[model samples]
Target chain A: MTTTEPGTAEEPGRAGPSRTQRLVMGGAVLLTVLLVGVIIGMLVRLPGQPPAPPAYDSVDVGFAQDMSIHHTQAVQMAAWERDHTTDPVLRLLATDIEDTQHGQVGRMLGWLELWGAPTMPLSGRYMTWMADAPGHDHREPGSSEPGVTQMPGMATAEELRRLRESTGPEMDVLWLQLMLRHHEGGAPMLAYAADHAQTPQVRNLAAQMLAAQTAESEYLRELLAQRGGTPLPL
Target chain B: MASGKTSKAARRNTPAPLKKNSFPWGTVTAVVVLVAMIAVIGTYVAVRSNEQQARAEALAPFTPTAQNPDPSRAIPGIVIKEYPGGSHVGPDEQVAYTESPPFGGTHDQVWAACNGVVYDTPVRSENLVHSLEHGAVWIAYHPDRVSGEALETLKSKVTVPYTVMSPYPDLDRPISLQSWGHQLKLDDANDPRIDQFIAALRLNPNTHPEPNASCQETTLFDQHNPPPYQPAPTPGTPGARAEDESVDPSRPMQTG
Candidate 1:
């Protein structure tokens, strides 16, 4: 038994590792690699680093770009109405929309400038950033032609021409109809941004826009109904 | 007990009996781990480099530098002129401009409301030129030549603020883009240079006299009933402001 004990110990020392021993060594290597990887990742994301600016394709940048374009048209329509409409109520509503949306445009444009993103979309496409958003379709419908696809609730050139030519009660009704639909169409975008934007300021702005547009929509509906004008189809 | 002792003695005597059966599993695992790590890091670096390359390519031509004060100079067939700013003319007067749609010169006291405005009818050149002084891009298209899909294409680019589009009656070209001191005429509305012009010069402080002037026309001008376009006054016509004529120092400069 004394000779067997020495032989067994000496054999293990001379021979290659056994299966269990090999497994332990492999596990040790794996653990070392994993620890190194974790350290590198932690260093990259260290809180001491200044926060990274939003990437070009980030949700915050996309929302600001798309919403700025959307609000421009609204401001244009409102500005026209504010100048031309004779009805006191319609004029008041138009003024509010003009002032609020114009200011909002300035704010969004300022954010985009700060983010170092183009004021216009680089792709010249709208709503592309909402591809993964639930219930939102960013694809242009039916027409593959580059510029034919417009955002929801945008007035056609013909419709705008008609509005420009119309006077008195006709102009009032048309403005309400158009603006009401514009508010409704933009609601979904505001909601999506509110939930998905990476920056808190963007999310807060989107939430505020959603709430204000919702309230304005109600007022628009009431005003349109009083004027016996039907809302435009979305 | 005797058989167990015999087996233990045989196992001890045969040195490296399991060595022949060993498959070098550790070496294989190490190689695989090393290769995976390289692939992960390599892929990440490649993707990041590609993104940076694409962004650089997109903005390179438009970004201004000290050597190239005006980046729009790279655009093909663009016309650059040196027109002094803050030259104001009365609404009733006309500027005898060298270019058909003058890029810059003496202009009306009032500027066209150019906050993404699309005027169905042709707007007066005097007022439109005033907008150009305020760092707005004017997209003037021939009404007859640009219709259907072509018209839509031009309108899409004007949706951003600091842009305005309207019909230019009897335009020599189908489309013409104008910033303060620049102009590019194109036969097709879908021409890529249309966007390039806008991206380079719209609201560019280096290109325009008034950098932060408001595009919104609060009081002086009426956008809905804007002044109608008329032919540029004949060069020596009475009371016409010549393109190179100096501004009247006594008159107050009109700020957009």
Candidate 2:
């Protein structure tokens, strides 16, 4: 039923008129081919150009935002511990955490700022990306998984106020407890990002962070025990 | 049958006028296709142009604000940042800078003493960047690559105030001369262009954001022991590349 005969009826003289029609058709096809070649050339060169960098909601982006804010609290609490603790080991550890975490904070913020992504996700939407895993959102415990709704292990405003206003051994104990919980809360995000971040650098940073925080958490628990402190219930 | 006969007569009478009207449709079809082709070609050209434009901006963030804006007349140095920046950094804080042996970006509150001091060890990057903001020139060399006569030749160039010389392990070039908004990498100890670069950009005022600011000051950091150069253990980061004398600037050096 599909045939080239529809246009054949319109051709009056096969020799003269058909030749002219064929020439016009050839010209149009050639023009289209030339135009298509230009499109292909542009596409072939596209990957070589660096992308506009990460956007606000991308995994690499969301990880940087969440971790930067997460690290800020650690630095702050470490400073609190530095001010409150008298134990030489605890003081040294606080100082170490303060120094290195502040530096890492600087690096992370530097990357986010350079990438033009927000330093933190807009309020309320934090860690919602973790919703990707099934059934765990309910099983995650505390606010979502560790404690509180903002992020895993994040101290509530009331808790931060308490940590800030408290003094002496109480302050030391509070600082240690809060920091330990914070690290534990941060674990899921880091673990997720380590396996799933789009950028190699993001993955590399997550790996470094996982190792460092793991070691620090172990040290944190040991110090808590040395002070005859028990781990806070999640 | 009578209507068909009358229509056939009308068709015969108006054949030339009808043919003329039909010719315009063929022209219109060709016109439509040509317009479509132009649109596609235009879109591709625009995207390609935009990509090149973005790359060009990324390649040179800081342009030479020399008294003369002529590129050829400008001192020969690769563009570092394709953008201009002036962010203030805290004196004690660590800045994750975009360039190693930074030319200019956010810098610490205090400037390093550029009062004709030739440091034997590498100075803190924060202070060095601050000094550049005050319109001083910094000459950084690899400790292993340039020494003895080459070292002396470089030092002689830094005898005046607002100039300082030190070792920078991260530099891919053996020596790089930096003033505010400009830097030139020299393979040889005695490139005549070295002097030209200094004379053109140093305290040029046109390039310096604060030309009147003093370079003679010091605080916190010791005169003798500048922070030791330590490369980051993480490979491919700027800190990791700090210890290696990465030779080609064209190759991706650490950005943050």
How well does candidate 1 score on lDDT at residue B230?
88
DockQ, structure candidate 2: 0.04
Candidate 1 per-residue C-alpha lDDT over A54-117 given as tens digits, one digit per residue, 9 for 90 to 100: 7677788878878877887788788778888889988898989988987897888677656556
* lDDT for each residue of candidate 2 in B106-150, tens digit (9 for 90 to 100): 555667767456888888776787788776789999989999999
Cα deviation of A155, candidate 1, in Å: 2.7
- Candidate 2, pairs of clashing residues: A140-A145, B60-B81, B60-B82, B61-B81, B61-B82, B61-B83, B62-B81, B172-B246
Model 1: lDDT equals: 0.78
Worst 10 residues of 2 chain A by lDDT: A1-10
lDDT of 2 by residue, A1-234 (tens): 222233342345232436656687678778778877876876675766876666455678777767766776676667667766677777898889878876776677566656644444433246655556554352334354321236668776568668766777787788888989998888888988888787788889888889899988998899788777787765
What is the alpha-carbon lDDT of model 2 when measured against the actual structure? 0.66
DockQ of every candidate: 0.13, 0.04
- Angstrom error at residue B61, model 1: 4.1
